[model samples]
Target chain A: MKGLLLKDFLMIKGNVRSVLLFLVVFCLIALEGNDFLLFVPALISFMMFMTTFSYDEYNKWDPYAITLAVKRKEIVFAKYLGSFILLFFSLIITFLVALGIGIYNQNFDLQKTFTLLLGCGASILFLQDIVYPLFIKFGVEKGRIGLFVGIFLLSFLLGWILKNVSISIPQDIYSFVVSYLPWILAVFLLILTIGSYEISKKIYTKKEF
Target chain B: MKKILEVKKLKKSYGDFVLGPVDGSFPGGVIVGLIGENGAGKTTFIKSLLKILQAEGEIQFFSNKKEDIGVVLDNSFFPEILTAEDIHKIMKNIYKNWDSSLFFSYLEKFSLPKNKAIKNLSKGMRKKLEIVTALSHHPKFLILDEPTSGLDPVVRKEVLDLFLDFIQDEDHTILLSTHITSDLEHIADYILFLDKGKVVLEETRDVIMDTYGILKCGKDEFSKISKEDVWRYSESRYGYEILVKDRDKIKKKYPNMIVDKITLEDLMVFVVKGRIL
Candidate 1:
């Protein structure tokens, strides 16, 4: 596991643009008057993780990786964990910078902004949990296209539902959903990820090269 | 002797090309050369053994009491950005017996700078890096596909020597596939030749070397030998040159036949695409 992590870091180190983009987004979010930019860093981090994985897949290194003694379970977990770690750190930086910007601007509200940022971050994690399995099962090329398209369509449909429905009953629905959705999605996708790992293991074991 | 690697009735299909239900085995302490022309299922066979493609077969591996096999292929293991050190770390997690010290030592022996990224290295250096990592693990079996293809003779010789070092142990076994038959002629104990997705010849190197003979005969004398015995014959200014599988029979039948030593390449040509007499 340590070896796999070290290797991942080393390979990612070659792509300096990713880190630079992370920083650029972090700074951009810090300066934004609204809390919208906070979500950008997390989204970018997740996408960067996806991109790194895509690069690995394109080169056909997965079979060699499995031969190294690391189980399929660990490979999937490491990727998920790596993305989360990067997201966590990027959020912290964005939060701190946003706080600094709030103090500088003298009009920013820390409490409300932090709340929005947290909600957005959790939603990103939820989306990732669902998308990762697709990537694993179908590979990044077609899976990525399907993922983004699905997300866009789902978001659009949700927007249509929110806009058309005149039910004025629940103001706490956003917080309610945000609070429970990530946990539910995480547990469900964790199970799905495990199943994906088993499939990957079976596929790899049968593969000849 | 323990069986280091075995492949039984392995079959794989790629659209139009089909790699058979081919069965072969390699015992410990022997080097097996998998020789075939381009697109003759050499890579497919190696891939099948490594389980790199989905195939139906039984592949058993001995050594470390596990199916732990080392793979030394072309420059396809590490991506362009990862360094040797990075690869060392990655592989340590993959191989229970991965020895970092051994890996670095092999890298140093090859004069490969550990800090330099893989993409920056020359082709020969990249190949050396792949070999270093593949051999670092204490694997009992190795599947090397085209390890010596497209390299200068000097470097090829060096890599060949490394392969020799790999099988120095009595328990180690290797299936080295290449079109460069001469490189393996000296070390290979057994040779399996594949022509068109089929095993055309499978025998000990000594038997192959002993069996086939290139004979020089006058045009008139060529008529004396049986046409079935002639694998391929060529007409030259001096006379007729021919390849015969059963050289002893021909010599006994035609005592005046000028028989010469045949190389593995000669045998392959005659067996594969050689012009019939």
Candidate 2:
């Protein structure tokens, strides 16, 4: 299991262009002050995760990889675990950078820094929850189209709800929502991850290969 | 003595091509050659064994676990960005008995650069790497599909010798599928020839060689042989070359006719032609 994880990590390392792209994007986000920097880790981690799926598709490696003793569930779980691991590391690195910038700008809000990480992580996890199953079922080629469309619809729905419902929540309540949002998202993602894994496993298990 | 692999009533169809429950079994301790023409479903059958195709069939190994089966497909298993070392790490975790020491030894023997990315290696080198990996696992059954398609004779011989050495254990069996029939003439114990979607012939190499013969005779003498035993018949200016399964019977009946030795390639040609000899 550790060997498989190491292989995935090395695969990510070997693909220089994708890693370089993440680094470039991270450096660019650093110039936007501390607020944007908070999302850097999530963005980079998601980028790495998304690219792995694409790489697998482009190379047609999944059919061969799954043939090994590694179950389809493990493949699916590994992706989720790997993504989160990368996400966590990226979050730590970006938070430190954001802190440095916050100090430089004299707007060092540790609370906001924590909130941003929490919010970004939650949103990305939800996206991961949704995208993982899509990739597993439809594969990377056509599945990606659905991913884009789904994300678009999700963003649109969120925008509409925010625009129409202007409930005047107190600041304390808003802070409460922000603090618990990750937990709520994490719980939802956990359920979705397990559900998605089962569905993917069923699809993969019955798959002819 | 036991069946190592059994594919029963396996059925797969493309728009035009179809392979049937290619009922066949690989018993332990022999090299089986799956011979077929282009698009004759040789690779398809092999892929089905490895479950590469989403086809309907039941494929079971003699052992409860499939880890004992090592598959070396025609193409590179890993992507170009990966080096041999990376594959070793991945395979070590996947196979229960992955011998890293043996794998490295093969790498050294094959002179494959351990650090070079697979994408940078030539086709032969990449294939060699896959074979090295396949062998190092100590799999009891080695399933090779078109492993020696376009290589020079020298490399093909080397690979064949490697396979010969692999089956030294009585428990080891090899299922090699190839279009190059001549390459398998010496090593293959049993032959399974596929044509179109169906199996044309499956028999021991010696039985096929000893039983089948090409009889050269005039058009008049050809009518004397039974059509059931005649596989294929070709004509020329002077006479006809007929491939007969019961060569001795045909010879005894037509003593005057010239009975020549037949090769596996000849049998394949005649069988695929679907003609009476």
Candidate 3:
């Protein structure tokens, strides 16, 4: 598993120039005080993590890796672990960058920035949790299509709910929900990621080549 | 002889092709060359043995752990973006006994650049790199699929010599699948021939070279040969060519008939293309 993770990191390192260029561009855009700072870094990290699968497919590395002494489950687990590590580093970098920009602008809302960053990080994790299993079972190309359609449907459902229904919550209930939202989202993310790992492992274990 | 590998009732099916019911026990310290026509299941059999593909079978490797096996697949390897140096680093962690110095020595021997990405290397260079990686781990068994497919004759000879050196230890074994039958003729101890997913022939190289013969005769003379002795026969404009076992027996039985020594290529063509008796 360490070998596999190291390979993924090396693969990313091979394209470091392009990755750095993209980061620089995103950082400049993020300095405009837009909410892009919250999500762009997470999205960039996710994209970088997903490209490892593309590299694997291009050279048919999975079949070759299977011939090695590594277990099938370890291969799946490595991808998940690599993604978490990338996400962690991306979160820290984004926090620092947001802080620099916030302090420079003299309107630093530490609480709001933290909340939005957590929400964005959780959203990206949710996306990964759903997509990893799809990629494992159906491969990267088909999985990308599935991801787009899923995003479309989710947004459509959210739009319909907002447009058609208005709910009035008691002040106490609303306050309780708002205060516990981060904890709720964290727990949900944990369950979803674990379930995704289990599904991906099952798919990979039974996979031929 | 001590058996190094054994398989029984092994089978795999995908799409329209099915490979299977294969049974064989290969002896240790010998290089077993697997030969077949396209889609003859040589690659499939190798994959099944390595568990790269799911197949139904009983496979037993004597005195060898999974980690002790090295593999060089034909079309699969490291990602194209990775350099040879990166592979060395990755494999050092993957294999408990990976010898980094030996790997670098092999890279130097093959003239493979450490910093160049795999995509930049020539096809033959890539193959040499794969072989180098397989050898550095000190595996007890090596399973190679077309390990010398793209090399020039000179590199091919050097690679073949390397295989010869690897099996100097009587405990080591190699099962190589290749289209280059000439390489097998030079180094293979046993030939395992496959035709349409079945083991048509598996014999020691000495037995194959000494016992198998091609009998060239006219139709009238061919008619005199017993059907049991004719493994396969093909008719051309001038005469009929028959593949026969026990060349010396047939030669003694018919002193006037011409029976020439058979090569692996001749044997494969006869088995795959000639009419069965």
Best by lDDT: 3
List the candidate 3 regions with Cα displacement exceeding 4 Å: A161-173
Q: Any runs in candidate 2 off by more than 4 Å, and if so which?
A: A15-34, A154-179, B14-17, B54-57, B236-239
Candidate closer to the true structure by DockQ (higher is better), 1 or 3: 3
Candidate 3, residues B1-277: lDDT per residue as tens digits?
Answer: 6888999999999888889799989888999999999999999999999888889989999854667898999899999999999999899888999999999999999999999999999999999999999999999899999999999999999999999999998879999999999899999999999988989898999999999999999988988999899999999999999999999999998789999999999999999999987
Kindly give the stretch of ten consecutive residues in candidate 3 chain A with the minimal lDDT sum: A35-44
Model 1 chain A poorest 10 in a row by lDDT: A200-209
Residues B1-277, model 2: lDDT tens digits = 8778887888889888899868888898899999988899987887777776777878778986667877777653766678999998888887889999999998998789998998898888888887888787788889888888666788889889998988888899999998888877889999998889898788999888788899898878777766775677887899788887777887888889888888878888877774553
Best by DockQ: 3
Poorest 10 consecutive residues by lDDT, candidate 1 chain B: B60-69
Q: What is the TM-score of chain B alone in each candidate?
A: 0.91, 0.93, 0.97
lDDT of 1 by residue, B1-277 (tens): 7787777888888889988879877789888999988888988887767655667888766643433577776545766677887887777766778898999888878899988887798888888787777788877777888877677788888888877887899888888898889987878989999888888888989887887788898877878778887878877799887887777877787788788878989888777766786
Docking category of candidate 2: acceptable
Interface RMSD of each: 3.2, 2.4, 0.9
